[model samples]
Target chain A: GAGVSQSPSNKVTEKGKDVELRCDPISGHTALYWYRQSLGQGLEFLIYFQGNSAPDKSGLPSDRFSAERTGGSVSTLTIQRTQQEDSAVYLCASSLPLRDRGRAFFGQGTRLTVV
Target chain B: SQQGEEDPQALSIQEGENATMNCSYKTSINNLQWYRQNSGRGLVHLILIRSNEREKHSGRLRVTLDTSKKSSSLLITASRAADTASYFCATADSNTGNQFYFGTGTSLTVIP
Candidate 1:
């Protein structure tokens, strides 16, 4: 892909339902990140996946929020038992290996609205 | 808690004026990069400055980093209405350089 790609640009799910957002990073990139942003706010780090390393999950707001990256290329962010507070834009980014000091390229985010 | 915080949450300026935004982080960083977002969607990478480098320039953008203070600033010269957008700063931790944290963005409105 020419840039990072995300699926289901907009999602509106009932509260208590589960929704999954997907991200496909650029080929050969070794790092991926997920972030959530509320209306008019800065991005909140959600999770980070580095090549073959344990993901940094410190930023997940709660146990209901989880994400996984498969084959070092695609990632899925799952929000279980979603609440109204879960409404926000989910952004995914990918970068080159850390050794290369690469800047992140972002995808057109998924806007999730839990009603 | 590792997130960086940008100052002046919102700014408004006239075209041709310089716009400056500051960011401060808590820990040491291997490098810092700036991004611009429009319409609250995807962000575009603007500039990156390694920890060892004090300053870098790209077109009308100038970035400066001070490791000792764990802070960085982005300056846009001769701004235009098209430059209006939210700007964010991200840092890669020096320890692992894998954890990338973004700051609350500074929204700049360039009035023509």
Candidate 2:
């Protein structure tokens, strides 16, 4: 792909329902990351995947937030039992490798709004 | 725990003026990167400075890193109205599997 791509540019879900956000990173990139950003707030790191290694799940806000990367190419961020407070823009990025500098390419983020 | 913090939450300047934004982080970083976001989403990588390097430049952008003080700054020279956007700084720590922590961002508005 030309760059990182995220689906469902905007998502509006009701409280208690679950929502899934998707990200397709640039081909051959071995590192992927997910971040949540509230309006006018700093980005919150959620999860990260580096190659076939176990994901770094330390940043997941809660159990409700989980992510899976299959084939190390595409990723899915699922929010179980969504809450109003979860309303924010979810950003996905990919880099060449785990040690690559801060040159990650970001996607156009999926705006998730829980009503 | 967010490692990076940017100053002058908002900045306004006329086109052709120079805009400088400062970022301070509280950890050992291998590199620091600056990004620009327009319309609240999609960020474009502007420049990256390795910790070992003191300064780097790319076109209209100049970046400086002070490892001892754990701070970095981005200078946009002769800025244009198209440069109006929110700028963010991200710090990458190698020991942490290259995880990055981003700052709240400095909103730059270059008026025509």
Candidate 3:
């Protein structure tokens, strides 16, 4: 893909339901990141995947939130038993390898609304 | 907690005036990047300055990084209404280059 791509631009799920958001990064990029943002608020780091190394899951809000990157090209963020407070835009970004001075390119985020 | 903190939560300026936003981070960083978001959607990368570099320029955007103060500033010269957006600063930790943290952004409104 020419740019990072995220699927299901908008999602509305009932509380307690599970939701999954997908991201497809640009080809050859070695780093990917997930972030959550509320209405007009700043981005909150979720997780980071770098090459074949272990992912940094330090930013996941709770045990209900989890993500996985497959084949280093696509990633899925899953939220179990979603709550109303989980409503926000989930943004995904991909960048060049860290050794090459990674500069992030973002995708149109997935806006999740838990009713 | 966010590594960076941006100054002036919101700013309003007339078009053609210069707008400057400041960002401060706590830990050592490999680089700092500025991003702009419109309509609460995806962010567009504006400029990046490395730890060793003090300043960089791209068209009307100028970025300065002061490692000593762990601070950076973005200046937009001759701003236009199209420039109205929310600006954020992100830092890549020196210890973990892949870990990126973003600060509370500065909302800029340029009046035409």
Enumerate residue pairs that collide in model 1.
none
lDDT of each: 0.93, 0.92, 0.93
Estimate the Cα RMSD of every predicted model relative to the unseen true structure: 1.0, 1.1, 0.9
Q: Which ten residues in a row are the worst by lDDT in model 3 chain B?
A: B92-101
List runs of model 1 lying over 4 Å from the truth.
none
Cα error of candidate 3 at position A78, Å: 0.4
lDDT of 3 by residue, B1-112 (tens): 6568898899999999999999999888888999999999999999889999999999999999999998999999999999999999999888867777898999999999
CAPRI class of candidate 3? high
- Poorest lDDT segment (10 consecutive residues) of candidate 3 chain A: A95-104
TM-score for every candidate vs. truth?
A: 0.97, 0.97, 0.98
Model 2 in CAPRI terms: which quality?
A: medium
Highest-DockQ candidate: 3
Task: Indicate the TM-score of model 2.
Answer: 0.97
Better of 1 and 3 by DockQ: 3
Consecutive 10-residue window with the lowest summed lDDT within model 1 chain B = B92-101
lDDT of 2: 0.92
Q: List the residue pairs that clash in candidate 3.
A: none
